[model samples]
Target: MKIYKYILIGFLIVTTIFVSNHGGNVSYALFYLAIILPIISVIYTLYVYQHFRIYQMIDHKTIVKGELVPYRFTVSNEYFITYRSIQLKFYDDKSQVVGGDTTVEYTLLPGESIEKKTNLRCNYRGEYEVGIKMVVITDFLRLISITFPIQSKYRVMVLPRVLNLSRLRILPLEKDAKRTLTCNNPEQIEMDNELRNYVYGDSLKRIHWKASAKKQTMQTRKMTQNPRQEMNLYIDLCKLDVTGMDQIIIEDKMIEAELAIVKYCQKMGVPINVFYQQDGPQKRRILNAMDFNKLYQESPKIKFNQKVSVHELLSKNVINMGKCLVLVHKLEDALCIQLQRLKQNRAELVLLYFTSELEEEEKVKIGTLRSIGIYVREILREEELVNIL
Candidate 1:
């Protein structure tokens, strides 16, 4: 096409010279038509793009890291001009298209619509963008091409996969001498009890309407006592420079180990308390096996580069002096210091340390954690997840 266009243009130039020299009307008319053809082609290309519509759809909004997510791209031409060369280009650093083709080409006539389907996969855990990033349109003569950027955005959460482990064990601390009263049912608590500031995990039904009306703030009925010792799941979401694929694997392993422990605790009918962070103060949630989906849905919302650390979370006096599982992606000196403090409080600590490749220094640190009577286990492989928890 380029060769033909150049030949015609050259002929038009020669014809113009011939008409200027010999004054022939035929040559003058040919030159004028040649000049107008390219102008029309450019105008047509621009018009086709202006009227094109694009829409995107995805099959699943939440998917595991290793699973394939299906997406559909719909492009339609609403103008009278036919698009000879149309391409839809989309790309994201966080995800990869399954077939390795980020651009899809098509030929569309007037009022024609086309739909292209593809699959996407992401290795890391977080919310990833998936939509039309740009579009490329060109004329049939290959004279020029135009690219239009589309801001249409869609987000899909990539959740970490968990290992289904069997034969897991959790050694709890010695039972306390005092037990909770038999009338300690949560639902049976009187609504007219003491009022306190509303917390995230508090049930809305326990809201104190009278106090809220007087104080101009939401308040929840405070429970007198929480007798059952709850199991704690502490996940470390501190920011890390994850530049290598190995580091990503370590992150996934850390999440997997956490899930395995949660599953085991839920199976044993234990009341669990979850603690983690994302760019703010650490958040806490108390749940049981029946609320497992809540944990699954909330894990992917952790944004990268958050400042919360495992040491800051564990050092706080929030956790009860009972059994706790600490899932960490990295082992730091400060974290070890906090782990030692749990021993003085008589809190049973189990550490699942995830690493891609361990160094001698890390091994020695793990030994130090173990020396403090904290059960420490290294999770380097996917298979180790079965027993590490």
Candidate 2:
């Protein structure tokens, strides 16, 4: 295109010199044509920009992450004039058009429409715009080119991929199951000898009718304090320093790992308490499949832009005897110290650190945590979750 522009400029200069040196009708006509050629090219480009039609469609607006979706787009020329040197640019940051080039070039004749059919795959979990981002139109002369940004964009919501694990390797399923069953039995509720006045929100089953009658007031049985025995799962919601595709990959993998673990716990009849920070501290107790389903449905909306880090949230909570699973994108000294403390307090700690590559410093931190009896797993990719967990 640059070469064509330079040649045209050289021709215009020659035409100007010829008209100045000679007095002939042909010379003047050539000079005028040289000037009018560029004007006509610019006008043709503008005309094409206005008349060019683009239609993009996807089979669904909501799709699972990494799932292939059928997508097709059509470019048409409705006018009598032919459209030349048309190009397309797609949004390749978070989503991709499978088996298709990123930039597609085409030429359309009068009333001609070209349609491309392919599959679209979203690489992450979130709501983002996809498909044709911009259109580049060039004139036949290649001297004038116009890039028009597509006003209306195609958007889709991508849900996180949930993996079904045959069994949890990090956790002793049989032993944990037996302990969980023993702890959750209603018959194991030990009542204190002391009774207290029945509160308005107290359960009716806990009311001691005989004690209430003797005291001429409603009394409730005081239950013995049970230690924190349920599995605690923490998701790191703090935004990483990385941006663009790197951030997307880390956040998506963390969410997928959390969801997969939740599903596995539900399948194995293990109750889990998931903790994260959204607006503030958020916790979800998953004891059944329905609870896991609700969490799965809301996974796409979960953002990692929280001001609170997972370590801070853990510090605020009481960590006692139970399994603690922490999923974090980055490892910090403060977080490692907190994990060491949890381990010292007899809390079984499993750290799922998500990273593409481990640096020397990170490797040392991971080793230190593991040395202190914290089960640390560095997840390099989403596919490794099945074997690692």
Candidate 3:
């Protein structure tokens, strides 16, 4: 609060009353003026405090990116008077506090609530805290002031934006359409309702909000497993590969290869099982009837969070994918040996090894895997992926 305004007003009033009464006629008018100034200021301050307090309420506890989210804030006052210049402030988790302050002005009556709403666009993905940082309310006479809390905070979750690209080729190598998935099918089993913790690429639908709020941590959501016939997606990331000129190039290739596999499985109308080597064994997660756009984006982040080895993934979970398809970065003898073993043991699968470094190796592994009952083919050049098989 600005004490100078009150002091100045009191001084001016006292000077005027004392001068007028002493020089001309009113007797002890200054004494009456002094009595009234304190009362008026006290009342004004209390009125301002009661009327200008702001409270913000957020509707969405957590939200996914690219979804329209809403928020409401209520401004209250003590008396039935309208405030003219009261302004509200806004802030979000990814604080780009370079603006000249965005504010909205409104009026309110005593015990009245003035609510305001606005939509937030999903720009960047991650966890976010959004709400009022500080609110400032002032008097028309330029006399008083007050500041609100430092952290007016609310929680929100923003996920990555996904674009639909299933039309593009480089899909999974398949012959007949597979239909092993049925919604809430008996193939699924209820695991644990208790959420553990949240991983980066977890589906937004799997989030357990009640547990998250209670624990105040990003909990891994666990739900009943569906009876989805698992299909394998082996991204041909040959360890003994060549040309590391651009990591981005290699990463893009891997992403495209994985996308092709996923799109193929999705096109076949079959449920897919995705795995990437993390800190431990290949972390397995099921993508059951997921949106095509979402599947496209999630395929790459798996590598960002884990260094996946195709051989290890196959050795561990090949039997689960049913008839599996492998995308190899190069035609290494080690991978060829593994494919031969898989096919020989009745683990009928397809292997497509694509080498940006060696186009010839793409079909090498395919031929080898097919020799032992596994249907396999090579996706050598980028153009071959776009062809209608």
The candidate scoring highest on TM-score is: 2
Location of the lowest summed lDDT over 10 successive residues in candidate 3: 177-186
Question: lDDT per residue, candidate 1, 1-389, as tens digits?
Answer: 56867887798889788888887778878888878878987897878777888888888888788788787778887778677777767665667665645455688888999877878777678776765677788788777677888756777888887666554544533354122112224323345577889999988888888889999999999775443556777888775545566666666676766676666556544566777776566545545555766777776775435577877888885356477788877788888888888788888788877666678999999998778788887777454555644
Candidate 2 has which clashing residue pairs, if any?
none
- Quote each prediction's TM-score: 0.66, 0.82, 0.39
Q: lDDT by residue for model 2 over 1-389, one digit each (tens)?
A: 99988988998999999989995999899889889989999899889988889999999998998899999999999999999999888888888988667455799999999998999999889899999899888899899788889988998989999988765676645455455543333234567878999989988988999989999999998988544356889999998877766678888888988998888777766678999999988999988879998999899999888988888978876556378899998898989988888788888788889887779999999989888888888888544566776
TM-score of 1: 0.66
lDDT of 3 at 51: 50
Better of 2 and 3 by TM-score: 2
Candidate 2 matches the true fold with a TM-score of 0.82
Q: What's the residue-level lDDT of 145 in candidate 3?
A: 48
Q: What is the C-alpha lDDT of each candidate?
A: 0.71, 0.85, 0.55
